[model samples]
Structures are given as structure tokens and as C-alpha cells.
Target: MICAGDDDEDPFPVEDCLFAETFSQDTAFTLFGQELRIQQVFGGNLGVAAAVWEAALHLCSYLEERSVEVRGRRVIELGAGTGVVGILAARLGAVVTLTDLPLTLPQLEANVSANTPSSGWPATLPTVLPLSWGQDHMNFPSDWDLVLCADIIYLPETYPLLVRTLAHLCKNTAVVYLSSKMRKEHETPRFFEECLPSRFNVELVHLDGSQNINIYRASLRKDLSQDLD
Candidate 1:
């Protein structure tokens, strides 16, 4: 699906891949029965945000297994590095949006454009936008069927903002599929402390052979984020 690291996925060097000024020529993968080509950029051009992480691959497989549920749904993939998960959802007929930091747009747009099935590019090409965590809340849509993301919790400090951002962007009824490779053990509990049993409901999504990695399914308990002043 979306392979980059070995099975015991070590933390990717974000400083090198995201902050280093460089370019990696396009690479292709078969995800959800469709092939995708991604053009990766690093350094000033882009960051770790442009590389296809291993969690993305696992998420792709997970989504493919549930394609029937995905079709015709309103989906958004945030922190959409290289757009693999979002593109996969689009391939399955979901109306999808791919969101990431502003710089990743070049690569995100390129990957979606080049890999879209020839017969359905216009309909399948996703809306690309910048969705910085914990920042502006006005730009994002309030309704979503599913919000998808992978390997987004590498930075421990951003966990609260990420949870808050999700609460703000998704409807109380929406589902969120978030996959995280445990780069730092403390990070997840920190997230839970910030989000659980209060603003959102969360559960572990067990997948075969991925004991170290976790796929968490979260949904808002109530639309309490809007009450913030």
C-alpha cells in the first residue's frame, strides 16, 4: 500500500525530511487496488509532511477493507502527508478533502492530479487546503462523515491542539480514524487526558500484526468546542 520504513517503523527524521531543502522524485504504490504516484519534497520545499509514512500504508489497507462504507461519504484527511489516505478514499468514490500545511500543497496537489484514474479525475480530484492545527477555526467545514489521518502525533506538544482541531472540524456524529505509530509512549495518554470522556469518545482499532502501532477511532461526544470564547 504505502510503504516507507521497515516493520518496526522507527521514527522518521522529521528534521531531515521536512526541514531539509530537497526533492525526492515521484514514487508509485498500489493502494486500495489503484496505483498512486507521489512526488515528495523536503527541506524548505516541504517537510516530513511530504513523505508517505508507514501508518498511511496500514490505514490504506484498513480503508480498502471497508470501501463499501466509504463510497459516497464526505471524507477529510488532515495532516495529509503526500495525500495517500485521502487519495485512496477519493478512488473509492468518496467526496474527499486533503488538508495539510501550506507548503505540502505542491506535492499534495501533484500526487492527486497524476494518480487520479483517467476516467474520473475531475470528480475524484480532492479539494486541497491548509489546515494548521489549533489555529483558525473558521475555514474548515463543520460536517464530515469520516476524518482520516496517520502518523500525526509524532510531536508531543501538539496533541491537545490536534484533538481540539478535530473537535472543531467534525460534527458530533462524525467518525475519525487516526493511526499512530508510537514514537513516544507518553504522547497518546496525554491526548486521552485532553480529550476523553469529556469532548470525545475514543477506542482502539485493533488490526492484525500492528501491536506497536494504534488505529484510534474517535468521535465527538457533543459539539462542545463551539462554546469556547
Candidate 2:
């Protein structure tokens, strides 16, 4: 329902727009037993990426409920948007890197700074970086324990690039956890059905039928792993 881009011609679902307006500049969320204050920028050139999506919250809940082992792990979040999921992972003791497009970094950085503690965790603090999928993915280290993505597969044009980036980042035992809303208009199924399976063995670990959101766990295919080596 959220508009994908800043184009005037882009279709903006009325219900989604109304939902967006319900938030103030800063919204608070309780995840992983901590309160996080996330700043949201609406109706800008940033589009839907500036706001915290339902998929991000659902992913956070899944991680918390499943007791995912992120502690002391090398985790990176792509298309981080409001930085909620990555920040939550950091709170859970992971060395997290939150990445998004160049324009989205400022807000993302702000949210990370506001939510993340100044110090005291055994793990390294979360870092923020700008990563455009496929364009500069090679600049990043291929060695990661976990790759987190939330609501990033809406744009079909970026599907191949996203898959390529995932294939590169998920080396050895690295796993990817992606949460997305099943919006038919955005062709959300195509990324899971076609793009991701091309590089990784993807599984639907959880599904929230009420919200139409899905959480997928993916790992590099054995064949692709051999090819990378």
C-alpha cells in the first residue's frame, strides 16, 4: 500500500497514507523489552523508506520470540529504513551495521544514535553506512553471520541487484532473515519465488496472515557456496 518512490505518478494507497499520518515526528516502540524512539520523515523524496513499516516490527517480534542467537555476531541490515530491526539486534548484543540508500542515511543514523546506548555492551556498537544494492555491495566484507532485511523487496527493478548483493554478503555460514508485506501490486512474491531462490535456499519461517507479512530465513545454496570459493 505504501508508495515505492517519490514520483508524482506513483500510486499512493489512501489507507497507507492515512496510517503514515497517524505518527508524529518521533514514534516509540517496545521491542526486545526496551523502548525505542524512532524518528519518521514522511511525504519527502525519501518516500516509504523514511517510515517504520509493519514488516520491520514483525521481524523484530519473530527474532525476540524465537530467541535468535545474535549475540556477539556480525550482522548487517540492508535497506535499514528507520533502523528499528538492526537497532533491536544491536540491543540483543550483536555487532550490527545498518545500511540504506545515501539519502536515507541521515535519518537512519539519527535513529540509531537516539536508540542505541552510548556504551556498556560487550559487543561493538551499531554502525550506519550507505549501501546501494548491487552497485557497491562488493565494497563490503563478504564475511557476515547474519544479514537482516525488512520490507526491501517492493521494487521489482532492484530484485536482481538485491539478490546479487545477498549472494555476495552471505558467504560461508551467513544467513539472511527478510520480512516483507505480501503486496501483490509490488510483486512481493517474485523476489521470494524467483530472485532469492536463485542464490539461496529460502524458507518461510513465519507468516502473519492478519497483516499479510512473511518472514523468510535464507542461507547460501551449497552449489552457490562452492561457486563463491
Candidate 3:
């Protein structure tokens, strides 16, 4: 699965294989006028959550193009794989928390440390934490101003859990920005069409036809917010 760089004429090059074998590599991205070096680990013990996906890049472009203001806001990125989105949020002045499974925390922390230097803006570094959706979401406070999710809605099994965690974290005026690749085979459409709307007021904010990716903005429905209160 995971192959080395192109230099090795390996048939299964790991440059962008979604489910490749065990290999380590670094890729660079330019966002918000800064170049970010993202280290990606494939296969070994990691799942598809190790590489930087196109959905993440698409979401980052959306943020930058729309000039979304994240300055001084409390932002948390759920299922933050390579920490790119959260790191960009930090670069744009938001206090960010990049969270994922415990197994992914080490790489996430390393990415954060690499992109966000000590002299970075906002004066505070992005916090990396271990967060498994719906299991221990209660441990985190429900006071985020913005919740960022990139390419997280793929597994149908995690739909309920993901929604529960979203409802628990997005309280008051908090909003969730989720970017997902629309794969027909996967249950991505069901999550956007039915699951997410059941709990939050979901809206289609942006759509990338070329990539079949959509960016959705969601917030706790009035009734859901009342129930949470």
C-alpha cells in the first residue's frame, strides 16, 4: 500500500494513496499566505486518518477565500487528522484545539508544533487533545464559538455518535463548519441529508462541483438548544 516517493518506481506509490501501507512522508501546503509542512504517516497502525485529504484543503481554501473571521474566537477541530485546518485557524487568530483519537494525537501534536511556532499570532499555541466522538465528549466544555470538521462524515456507524458529540459541543451561538467529500458508496450523503439536520439547523454554504465536496454550516436547532439548556 504505502510506497516511497516517485523516485522508487514502486507500483503503489504512497504519495496520495488513501489506504496505503506503512510509510512516513511529508507534504507541504500553502494556505493563508503561509507554507505548512505536514508530516503524513500511512498504514502501519494508522487508519485513513493519517494523510492530508483533499477535503481539508478545500475547506481551508473556503475559509481563506471567504475571509472568515476567526480572530479571538474559540475553535475546536473534530477529527483533526493532520491538524491543517486547526493550524490555519490558529494562524488566522483563533484559539484552536486540534483533537482526534489518542493514537493520532502524537502526529497531530507534531504537526501543530511544526506549523505554529512559539512566535505565532494569538500568543497561545493550539492545544492537541485526545477526543473520541460520543464517548468522552462530555469531558470537553460545550462553549466553542466554532467547530471545524473536515472529511469526517464517511462512516454510517459513527453518525449517531458524531451527532451527539456535535450537539454536546456546539452550544449557544456556536456554529459547526463541516467539509466532506461526497462519496455515493459511503454514507456521507445520508449524514448531511438526514442525520445532521435532525439535530442542527444545517445549511449548504459552499459546494465544489469539480471535487464533489460540500461545505456545510450547522448550528444547534432552537429546540435542541432548549433541550440542552
Candidate 4:
């Protein structure tokens, strides 16, 4: 069933251990004059996926203040666990595609539908699809202006495939934005530098505290690895 919560309620009980395990809710997040309702898949408090989405929303608001128009852009968010970022992008006027592994698509779709824009707003909401990082290339749209991902790089096995998928799917002008909480040795930037030399242009734009999560703008360019020393 669909769980709902008001603005002031923390719904998840931090005190009780058992009550925190199974319940999930659709929470409302407001920023930049846009009210986005997102679904928390695993219940309790906001998980790591939603936390990263919160950070991404903050960054989006920061950019919006600087006159960066997020509206009417083609955006794709990979590994969208709870579909928070992509759904927010749609609410802000972008045509977004939210994708994750096949198993996660159902919940993702529910989140997308739960957070859809109002009637007077934009007509097209985000499209939810099944896209495994390196496995399935089942008809993705070309010429995307922006690609977003959050908290997907913790697993080292998926590094190469992630880079290659970004290279193949994103256009030359496409900006890839990613955020993650890395372990002590699992630096996502290092993974990008190691794998992106041959096919894409990689630049580290922002790094959060503790050097764990980072924002990168990866664009497609020729001979991008010339400076990979």
C-alpha cells in the first residue's frame, strides 16, 4: 500500500528497532520553489540513496540560483534507487528517464508516479526503465543533455562497465553528474580516471566532505586521455 506522511512528522521511529524495518513512505521534499514527493523504498528514515538525492537537490537549487535552467532538458539518472533525483528533475521541468536494474524498476516506477508534476506544470513526467549498468542497451534515447547518478560506485566490480556505459549513452555535450559515499580505498574518482581515459572527458567538479562523495561532469571528447598522467 501507499504510505503517506505530513510535513512535520518523522514517521520512522528512531527508538523502536522492530518498527523501523518494514514500513516505507512517500515523503514530500520542497526546494527551489518546487515541491517533489518521493518514495522511500526501504522504510524507516531516509536511506543513503535518498540522502544523496537530498544533496543533489541542494546542488540543483544552487545552480538554479545561478540561472542554470534545469527545465526542458533531457536528463537520465542511473542507479536511481528510489527515483528521487530524476523525479525531482522532472518536477523542475526536465524530461527525465529514471533507470536501474530490472529488479528495481517496479519500485522505481511507483516512485516516479508518486512524484509526478501537477496538471498545470509539465505534461511529461519521468519515464522509468530497466537499465543495468553494463548489461542491457535496450533502446536508450540519444543526445541527452544531462546524465545523473548517485551512490552507485561503491561496488568496485561495476566501475569499468559504468564508464563504458556512460561513454556509449551520453552525447558529446552531455554532462554526467555522480555522487557516492566511498570507502577508505574505494575512490570513485580514481575509478573514473582509470576507466574514462579512452572514451570520455572526465573532470572532477565538486567533492563533498571526507572526500567520499563527488560530483563529476564527464563529457565526450576526442583524445581525452592526453593529460591522463
Comparing 1 and 2 by TM-score, which wins?
2
* Model 2 TM-score (2 dp): 0.88
Name the regions of candidate 3 deviating beyond 4 angstroms: 1-21
List model 3 lDDT by residue over 16-93, tens digit each.
544556778999888988788898877655566787988999889998888888889999999898888999888878
Tens digits of per-residue lDDT for model 2 on 114-215? Answer: 876656545877888988777788889888999999998887777887888888898767999999999889799988998889888999999989999999
Q: Candidate 4 regions off by >4 Å?
A: 1-21, 43-55, 120-123, 223-229
For residues 78-133, write the lDDT of model 1, one tens digit per residue: 88978888888888788999987776777788888887787885345689987777
lDDT per model vs. reference: 0.71, 0.82, 0.82, 0.63
Could you list the CA RMSD of all candidates, in the order they appear? Answer: 5.9, 4.1, 6.9, 8.7
Lowest-scoring 10 consecutive residues by lDDT in candidate 1? 1-10
| TM-score-best of 1 and 4 | 1
- In what order do the candidates fall by TM-score, top score first? 3, 2, 1, 4
Question: Lowest-lDDT window of 10 residues in candidate 2?
Answer: 10-19
